[model samples]
Target: MNLYAHYVKRIQDFLIALVVSIVLSPVLFTVSVLVKIKLGSPVIFKQKRPGLNNKVFTLYKFRTMTNKKDKNGVLLPDEDRMTSFGEWLRSTSLDELPELFNILNGSLSIVGPRPQLVKDIVFMSKEQRRRHIVRPGLTGLAQVNGRNNINWDEKFEYDLEYIGNITFINDWKIMLKTVLKVFCKEGINTEGLATSEDLGDYLLRLGRITEEEYTAGLEKSKVLINR
Candidate 1:
């Protein structure tokens, strides 16, 4: 790791986060109130997400879905329990506002590979595992380019590419393009979900397909989940 580069990145992240948080405080506060009322308790939904080097960090974001369950007390599917407020938050990209703190705290970068649930990280191939070499981001090459509509293979390829060429210029380009994509709501999600294909769910349904097939599917999934 480049020690000076890391520190420079961290300083930039801190400055941006501080400024953005202060500037967006009113919006964040309003969203918080709405989430509390509409989504019930636990206004901020915190979860363990894999960060740089596959380390774990408690990621913070607004609660976008309800905690409804079936008769057996099992949680409902993500698509079923998605609330109107949640959808709004997702469409506007407001749900991710809290992650600014994550960036400021040095747990993440402003731009890199997006973090995944720890369990999701387990299924990654050796090549895909390279994403952990750097701090995960709230947005990245995959995000600005394809988002939820891009397939897994494609997303992983972009991730690896980002890692290979970790230049300030490339990061800035991604940041600029991300703003446009977010405003246009391009590549947001598939027909039902807010992001990405549910590959983990697919594995369950497909049973034990060959490892080769699974790897192929994951690659496709990365792109399909992007915008």
Candidate 2:
């Protein structure tokens, strides 16, 4: 890795994330209150994601869905539980504000590959997994390019492209693009879906992986998460 990727980038990420978080503190507070009222308790949503070197880290975001469930106590589908308020939070990217702390704590950078689910990583090939060589980001090249709108293969291609050519100039370019992307409300979800398809599911749908492989990957991911 270059000096910037190896050393300078972390310092840059920390300083920028710190300043941005402080400047946005009021906005953060207001959002938190609104979320609590709208989404109920636990306004912050936490989930396990794979970070650098496939290490597990807890990713935080503002909760954008209710805990509504079926009569059998099964959680409803994301779309069914989603409300207009939550949709607005997602479209405005306000739901992502809490991730600033992830950056502050060194689990993320301001720019790099976005951290994906533990189950998602289990389905990635060795080359695709190279994106994890660096800390995952708050916003990334893939995020700015097309986010959940693009197919999984395209996302991985963009991620690998970013990794192969990390530079200070490139990071800034991506960050600036990310701001615009958020404002434009671009690529928040795949067409006709409340959430992007999981990698294993996508691969199985395309016949790239068998059902056995998909189930095994999910089981492996569970083990990794427990570890």
Candidate 3:
């Protein structure tokens, strides 16, 4: 890989995120107000996610769902907490606006593999673990290709492909495609799902994980998600 592509991309990500955040300040303010009214406090949904080399970082995003829990104290399903306004924000890709800070801070790149939950590491194969060789991105190869519509295996394939072909041109191409995808709202999600299933759940369905392993991973996921 070119030194510029690997080492200097962080500078590019910082500059781009700075400019984008400045330009989008008005929209960010508006969205913050709306989220406060609609989803209540903490307009930003902060979560721990694995970044480059599997290091953990706090990822930021505009909150789009209410924190309503069920009688059992477990959180409600994403579909249930996701209001129409929230869905609109997601469909427009506006909910990701806050992640510019993550890019600017060097926890993420403008283009790479999108970060998954800290607990999601349990589900990765040895090959899938290669996705974290580079910094996570705000928008990535798999993102431009299918977003939440594709399965976990397909996502890892795209991620690994991007890693193998990392270059300035490829990154820019993915960014441009991301813009078009956002405007068209293509692949925002799969049918009847607010988001893709958990990686552990997906592996369980594929029979790649034993029932006990899946349960253990699920517990870990809950702790990570709620932490």
Candidate 4:
């Protein structure tokens, strides 16, 4: 790995994330309060995501959905639970502010492949999994390029491309593009979906993976999570 990718990037990510967190403290506080008011307690959403080398790490974000459940005690679909306030938070990318801490703590970078769900990791082919060779990021080449608007195949393509060409210039370029993308409220969701489809679901829907494979992959992901 280059000096920037292997060593310098972590230092830079920590310093920049620290400064950004301090500067955004007020915004973070305000969002926290609003989330509590609108969505109740547990204002922060925590989920296990695959980080560098597929290591499991808790990814944090401002909670954007309610915990309302059905009579069967199942949580409602994301779209069903989404409120206007939550939609606004997602569109403005305010919900992502807490991830700065992940960068600060060395679980992420300012720019790299975005960390994906633990379950998604199970569905990825070996070549697709190459994206995890480096620490994941708050914003990534895939995120800046098309985010949830793009297909899974295209997203992995961008991820691999970014991994193949890691440079300081590239990171800065992606970061600037990310700011613009957020401001423009672009690619926050896939068409006809509350959020991007899971990799396993997308693959199964498209017939890229068989039902047996899908079920097995999901089981494997559960084991990873349990570990």
Root mean square deviation (Cα) for candidate 4: 0.8
**What pairs collide in candidate 2?**
none
Residue 123, model 4: lDDT of: 90
- C-alpha TM-score for every candidate: 0.86, 0.98, 0.94, 0.98
**Candidate achieving higher lDDT, 3 or 4:** 4
Q: Give the per-residue lDDT digits (tens) of candidate 3, residues 1-227.
A: 67976677888999989998999999999999999998898999998898888777899999988988999999998888989998899999999999999988889898999998777886788899999889989999999888989988889999999999888888899999999999999988776678767788778888999999988987876665665
Q: What overall lDDT, based on C-alpha atoms, would model 3 receive against the true structure?
A: 0.88
Deviation (Å) of 203 in candidate 3: 1.3
lDDT of 4 by residue, 14-118 (tens): 999899999999999999999999899899999999999889999999999999899999999998999999999999999999999998888888898988899
In order, the Cα lDDT scores of the candidates are: 0.81, 0.93, 0.88, 0.93
lDDT of 2 by residue, 125-220 (tens): 999999999899988889988999999989999999999999999999999999999999999999889988899889999999999999999999
lDDT score, candidate 3, position 110? 89
- Kindly report which residue pairs in candidate 3 clash with one another: none
> Please, what are the lDDT tens digits per residue for candidate 1 over residues 20-136?
999999999999999999999899999877788777788999999999999999999888888887988998899999999999888988998999766566567788889999999
Which candidate do you rate higher for TM-score, 1 or 3?
Answer: 3
Task: Give the C-alpha miss distance for residue 191 in model 4, angstroms.
Answer: 1.1
Residue 108, candidate 3: C-alpha displacement in angstroms: 0.5
